[model samples]
Target: MTEIRFLHIADLHLDSPFKGISSIPQSKWKEIRESTFHAFTNIIEYAVENKPDFVLIVGDIYDGENRSLRAQALFQKGMEALQAKGIPVFICYGNHDHLSGKWVRFLLPDNVQVFGEKVETKTLNIKGEKVHISGFSYKERHVLEGMHSHYPVANGQHIHIGMLHGSVEGNMEHDVYAPFRKNDLIAKGYNYWALGHIHKRQTLHNDPPIVYPGNTQSRHRNEQGLKGFYDVTLTENNATLQFVPSSAFIYDEVEVSCEGIVHANELINLMEQSLNSYREANGNAIVELTLTDISEETSELIQASSKEEWLSLIQESLEMDHTFIIVKELHVNLPNMERKESNMLLEMMEEWETAEWKHVLKDLYRHPKGSRYLPAIDEQFMDETMQEAKEILSKVVTRGE
Candidate 1:
């Protein structure tokens, strides 16, 4: 039995800027862009040191639109290094890297073989071992049907491996692109499946392992958790797969509760301690803090006049000496204290349940004019305003009394 080892990576999304991450400094944009290339270089270095049989890139080599020339050049350079070692590369186009025009073609290394628009299989004989590889490209934007049906089943005794970029049937919002099902692949009897398009690494089967190697670098906050590639070892008996984390920066969310806190300074201290503990655990990870269940006292403490001062303190403490550490997002959920008291406010709240009151309240909140004017009115002002309005002629509306 021939021992076959290979590296699998997907969804590099190269040349894509980190959008909506305003907390990241403008100077670090270049470093962030280069980090994707650095991760790819590390993969090549691993290949050189460990000597994998070949490398498989499932899909999304570049961002979908507005790809940069620099990204292409850097990708080629990394591939060149791998080619120099005589390790072959196989690539398939995911939705992001779908070809748009004829002028986009560049001369790739002779060792790289890119699969085309059709679902076809290529067989390569490596050291007396037969390896059957199959894949297809996305010619257009949306693929609502199954592209895997076109893949031919494994024939003879060769070790069959298939690579495609698609979501299996109804995987959350991923049902649009090359939708397929697990039973379909299992019935086809492929030795292994190298899948992509999903950014989270997951394995579907064990006997003849079906895997989603996931994205090489995370692109946004939505693509959270550990980001990396896979190393697969193929044997006659069974195939073994391992995930390797290669991301230069990790993205995570941290939640802090201020249920009983009375002072902003105390809250800040608690938050700083929480952040310190998180950094100690994660070691150089970017975080977004959500301050939830903030008490009435804390809310009153952080009024409009002192908001900047508290924010400044938070910024200073979070800065520290770590260059990589950053607070990507901060949100506060103020407690609803009015709900606890039973008085005229509670009666008004109960009145909010009536259809007439509900309709009037919804219109008041939804309409721009009503929102702008309603908060400034007293009881007499509201009565006069409602009398003049056409929509609230019959509704009994009351304001602060």
Candidate 2:
């Protein structure tokens, strides 16, 4: 009846260029760039302080297909910190960080045990308790075959945990890498399942605690909300899991009402207040503001030649107490104003519906590189966008009364 404690994290994405976010000052980008490292550092510190039996990084320790030496060094540093504290680490590489010939040169700490390219099991004794863990790493970029069939049954009597870095069978949002059905996992008879590949944290099953700890850091706006790891305590009777927040900056989108706002400074004030509220709830955050019900003055401000500069100024001004409220992009969704579709817009819509454009769009959606972050736009959504365009055009035709 002994309890086992460990830290579960995935997708640190070290040295992530954050390709999705663009058009900001280099100084700001530099600060934001360090966020992933900061998050990884936090996880290491927590492991050392808490002295967990082991740390499990399910997959995607690095961001890009080609691993960088700097990212490798930083990862080793974290491993060293845990090793110094007598904590063991288990790692499995996902599609993004699959093993390559280059890894033959990079060395990891002795305390770390990385799974190979085939499904295998490792047995360890922690605090006089025997535990059996099983998993595998992707040898190449794509692992379309079902590896779940290869997972052996749990060893008799020892605590069993299964690790997988792949998408669920029905998850069209992600590539079908190492895809497995939820029932397939349940059939394995493992005490717990640690999943990766998907950046969002989710619990697939509660009884045996099948979970995805999510990524340690958010790389883009698409990965919004609190990004961190899970602290799990397993007992003979029940398993308890707690989410520990370690991300340096939260990414979020906030909408502000400007029904009667007359001055740009007033808008800044409103945004600051909203940012403060977010900080209270989420610690520190990077925000994208969408202003609604914009007055004519605000509309004019939006159309002005210096709109980008003004937005940057607002972002710069929002900095206070070492917290940032960076407006990644500003959207002017004016209320009662027609989202007018001009002749050019109609022409573009027609082009979008054409077979050529559709084919291109599908290719982008199905691209292995993009499937991780960019969700495919569904047919219903495209239809809605077209209808909205027509409504906007009608409004434009009747405006200025």
Candidate 3:
């Protein structure tokens, strides 16, 4: 029986700076970026502890175009830790790390084996078993053709594993690089398939266990969820995969409703309470609060008050006792429909008032040459009308005084 285990990770996107981090205060930016490095350190520590047979990095070792040397050095150091334990590393270049003539000259470590431009397989003899690994380097940013089409089938008595970095069957909003289908991998007859590029953890086939371990750390909001890598254990032909959490700071979207919150202070209190609850649940996670279903009264309160004041209040309240927590505030004013239907007379008046403005404005900008000036003129007009509409609509529909 061939018993082999390995850590599967991809889309590290190392050395990539967090969006908007630089815009923040210099001190805050340093802290945020430090947290990013800390997350990476956690992953490295996990690798050192587990010490798998080998580590398979699918792709995106660094952010493309402006890849950082510091990131490359840190990644090399992390891999060196695993190498110290006599473990080897396999890498396949993704779109971010596209093989260019300039980058080709950089000498990689002896323990690191990167796939060539063409799909090729290499066998590693481990404990009287043949572990066949095959992958291809991304020649350019976008590859329209299927990379898997060129992959060879499982040869000999080895456990065949194929590593790739591309979307399969064109995943949502994913770059159509090296596009392939589910049936394609099954057809290839590889015992295991390790994929990258898409930043969400997914298992395509249970029988063969084709999977994408996702990014080691999330780079943005859209890539939200539990971010981590996978640990796979192979015995003969069967494989078992386990996902390990390696992110240092968790990002969460918490929704706070203003259902019964009529006063601004009441709303702030509720928000503080919600923040406290989220912190308890997430344990030092960074939170983005989405204040939804806000009433017109609430909207007026927000407009009357300074947004910076509200944010400062929450931030201060959150940090009162907790020393190491960061709270990012986002305030949204969603119109309350129930409040709008309370006054019938106000509603009718608003309709008539809006109609009068529309008619006058339409005639003023209705000339044949209107299209030329419409873009600039229409914007201001829309803004004024929207403000008027909000004021009238709020008074007419508000159920409460």
Candidate 4:
């Protein structure tokens, strides 16, 4: 009975073009742009220091199929660092950085073993223990086939790990790629399942230890809190898992109560107090602030003074503090629609919902030259956009200007 340790990280999304975070100028602009790179470097440093038996990078190593030259260069550098420490790395390309993508393809160190476009197993003998890893790389951007079916069962030797980068079937939220279910994985009787594609860390099964390490860094508000990898220790009998936070910055949403607040000074103080209480939040954060439970007078006053003005004020106040907290977005949620003709707003929303919003969005992205730069339009994105649109319209109608 031998115990082995490894680091499981996925969805690094290196050189990710962090859209929506920087609609306007930001403080520490250089750091914001390089946060993704910083996160990967931190993970590599941790591995170099701790000296793990091996490392597993499941998928989505780059932001896109056509990975940027900088991403490849930095990735190679990280692999080189691990090679120096005698740590072997296993990798599989996800839908985002599929094999079909065109790139100069920087040469990685010999310590790195990337799975091909077919389901295959790589066996490694480390520290008097045998470990078998099974995985596959995405040959195309859309891997609609049930590729998980191809994964072979455990070799019944020492340790068996199955690495996959795809969404579970029946997941309407994310596009289906190499889709499979929990039962499908469990049926194979693997020791552990290391998964990617989803950007929030979660554990599906505890016994066999099916898990997703999520992404290395937080790209936008949707991916909140500390983002990092899973430190896994596997024994013949059980598996112990611990999450390590390594993201340079985190994207989070902070909600403050506006119940009894009236004046901007009070609002400023409340926001400041609320902001201070986010202790778990890393030093650097791009917060999407939501002001909840507002009075009609407060709402009116807020509208009278432009929303941008309030955001600017908050942004300026935050800059005074040492912590780099930038209020990238401000949403004022009205207490109740007690104003006149509020029914019309609801009607408008209903109509908008009935209309082909996705169709309209598809048309907007029809231009090949322009579509390449657009971020993915998932259900969450549409919901957020719709909510913001409603809020904007509600402001216009409620103000009665």
For each candidate, how many residue pairs have backbone atoms clashing (under 3 Å)?
0, 0, 4, 0
Best by TM-score: 2
On the 0 to 100 scale, the lDDT of residue 94 in model 1 is 80
Question: Which portions of model 3 miss their true places by more than 4 Å?
Answer: 20-26, 34-36, 101-106, 258-269, 292-303, 319-325, 337-363, 366-368, 371-401
User: Which residue pairs in candidate 3 have backbone atoms (N, alpha carbon, C) closer than 3 angstroms, thus clashing?
Assistant: 339-397, 339-398, 340-397, 341-397
> TM-scores of all models?
0.79, 0.82, 0.81, 0.81
Name every residue pair that clashes in candidate 4.
Answer: none
Q: Candidates' lDDT values, in order?
A: 0.74, 0.81, 0.75, 0.85
In model 2, where do residues sit more than 4 Å from their true spots? 101-104, 295-306, 319-322, 339-401
- RMSD (Å) per prediction: 7.0, 10.1, 5.6, 10.5
- Tens digits of per-residue lDDT for model 1, 1-401: 59888888888888777777565655556666676777677677887887788988998888764457777887788889888898889998888887552234569898899898888887777889989899987786576769989999887488888897898787785545998889888877888899888888889888778888778766567777668898899888978888888776677888898778886568878888887787777655566777777667776765544544555566667766445556667766543533333234434534443455546567666786657765543455455544454233222232110
Q: Which has the higher TM-score value, candidate number 1 or candidate number 4?
A: 4
Rank by lDDT (best first): 4, 2, 3, 1
lDDT of prediction 2: 0.81
Candidate 2 per-residue lDDT, tens place, 216-308, comes to: 887788889999999999998899999998898878898888777777677678877876777787777777778777767777756664668
Worst 10 residues of 3 by lDDT: 20-29
lDDT of 4 at 203: 92
Candidate number that wins on lDDT, 3 or 4: 4
